[model samples]
Target: MSSNSTPYYFVPGLSRHPVMASIGLLGFGSGMTGLVNGYSWGAPLTIASVVYVLFVLYKWFGDAISESNSGQNSINVDVSYRWSMSWFIFSEIMFFAAFFSALFYARSISMPWLGDIESKLLWPTFTAVWPNDGPAGLVEQFSTMGPWPIPTINTLLLLSSGVTVTWAHHAIRENNQKHAVWGLAATVFLGAIFLGFQVYEYIHAYRDLNLKLTSGVYGSTFFMLTGFHGFHVFLGALMLAVVLRRAIRGDFTADNHFAFEGASWYWHFVDVVWLGLYVVIYWM
Candidate 1:
């Protein structure tokens, strides 16, 4: 085993996976502690910490890329990488599923039973309602996000981005490198704009509609489902950006384009999830 040409193409010496995971876990723990304790600066500090950590991660992965492209990732290493990525994506699916399940349980079980006309002796004031307004009843008697304005716009943006990614995929398969790069760039830009509008919508909800996270069960579930979906959208956009960067360098060809395909697949997944949210959370 006369190895030493590249750092990651072959097995490097013992690595620091544990230390890195611990750093992330510690940051999360402290942030959550402050949040639960009602510290004023908790949210801002947590966000800053995450941005710093992301910067560290970018530089670290860049170094690994330098090694792998230099012939470090051999056949065996590639196999392991594929398996790791598969499991990681599977884990993400489970994460999103939990939120969806929460939504289903709330709408189907809790609201119906609580509002049942039969429950006169129970929750007399409660009525089996589609939009429960707020659990604590703090919100100023409002309507849902609705399918017309912000939500519909976001849905179109996500759906169009999905189509663009598919176009980019086909272009790569046909060796139309320029189209692939430009299509991916457009998809990434749309995702960022969608995120921007979503943030603006949140501000409107908080200030104008009196719809904060603490409003009640309605607010809680609404934000939990949509907020998590928004975070996924942000992540998918970043993935597309990475794919576009590689495309610009002429790195992917038809048959050897799993990297781009994987990102595209994830973006499509996000779009599908958003469609569900738009219908359930917004319209009905």
Candidate 2:
């Protein structure tokens, strides 16, 4: 493509990024499987695969940035990108929905059925209850996590991040680079602090509360929901940081900043998920 002429529909030449990303994902999947099944090489392989994946993403995104900066991305391409991001967020919604459904089934339907008059013959001592320890000493006794200082604080942090990210979006749209940078920086900082508090909460769960993955269905569900959400938060924060870098370099204009908008979409999604988790997992 020439610098003076813009294509009607921009399509770059074939690249190896797709295959490279696939290879990284394959390695990551294999490493995770090995780690779960107790292989000595699993840890190193997982770490290496993560680094490789990050490297691939850095290069892939760099290429896209260059293309955008070169005016290769047309309005059609922007629309396509927006549609892709919307679908991706929808997929994420379904992912969380499945977990939420499982929690509901376990708590409302299955628990009540098991504790009813019919199943008492099979397990006489069993009681259908929230945060159960399972039948016949199958699960370890552990205290439940409640809506307390740590969870409440994390909720406040994420809520604050949502506001800051919105502020950044508005700032970017108004071409206020300074406010945009500060807003993004604050969002990232809040996300980091939220993750830190989550780590402390996990430690407290293990060391003081005796709450672990082996504690019961409750423990597994709690960790799976919150852990995956935390991972999303990490990804969102990373995206914001990248956008922040771009903002500092004056890469975004009043009308041309899908990257910032996309990152904000994801950050808001993360914030919403945490709110659900706070209500269902902690308060309920």
Candidate 3:
């Protein structure tokens, strides 16, 4: 196939990646189930599966990188990749939507319905207010997190990182490699700082505020939302770090930098999600 012209299609040969990824996922799922059931080998098994999956990812992406760097990728391939990444991000949006929907349902509908006159007749003392300690007070008292200090700090950090990443994109487009490198490094640094603040907030929530996952619906929603977002932040930081490494190695250029673009898109999506969380979960 001509490198300059779009080929009919760039069909890859059969590979073991799909089966291997499935095996790894299965093992990981089994390990998690076992660990939840208190099995001794569960932790080790989970670690093994995770390592396997990471290794597979490394090899798989390495091959794709080699293809791209070797000029095997055409405009068609680039377009396909862009579409795939867009769809992937859309799927991620739906994933977060489900969680956000659950949060809304719990707060707006379920809580009030449970606290209403008829339902409260069964449990007379159940408070309708949010962050309550449940009907029987089985859940321990805990303070809810406010959109202050650490969370606000994280919001700022993410916003700044967005700006930095955008600057990096612009620099790359302008063929200013040095500025691109600096911008990427700053973005990664900001992401790391955001994660640090999140970790500190979690520690404070558990220790000082008595907010555990079991602390009632409020705590459950709080941790579920924030914890998943934390994971996404870490993943986005890792993605940016990879892009930064590639930038330092002169991988991306003005004409071809979809990998960097994809990472930036993911990072921006992460930032937007956090903004939603801050307003809904923190402020609201």
Q: Estimate each model's TM-score.
A: 0.85, 0.95, 0.93
Tens-place lDDT per residue, model 1, 1-284, is 32232244476666564467468657866875687579976776677667766666666656655655455555566667677767877887788788778878877998877766676565576666766763345456754565668888988999899889988989999999999998999899999989998998898888787776666667777888888788888878887887788789876767556668777878888888888888778877
Candidate lDDT (C-alpha), each: 0.76, 0.91, 0.89
Candidate numbers sorted by TM-score from highest down: 2, 3, 1
Once superposed on the true structure, which residue ranges of model 1 sit more than 4 Å away at CA?
1-9, 116-119, 133-140
The predicted structure with the larger lDDT, 1 or 3, is: 3
**Could you say which candidate leads in TM-score?**
2
In the predicted model 1, the residue pairs found to clash are: 9-72, 9-73, 115-128
- Model 1 earns a TM-score of 0.85
lDDT of 2 at 240: 90
Candidate 3 lDDT (Cα, whole model)? 0.89
> Which residue pairs clash within candidate 2?
none
Please give the distance, in angstroms, between residue 52's alpha carbon in candidate 2 and its true position after superposition.
1.3
Local error of candidate 2 at residue 104 (angstroms): 0.9
> 1-284 in candidate 3: lDDT tens per residue?
34624564566778888899899999998997787578998999999998998788777877888878877888889889999999999999998999999988888998899899999789888888776778887898888898899999999999999999999999999999999999999999999999899999999999999998788888878888888899899888888898899999999889889999999999999999999999998888
Show the colliding residue pairs in model 3.
none
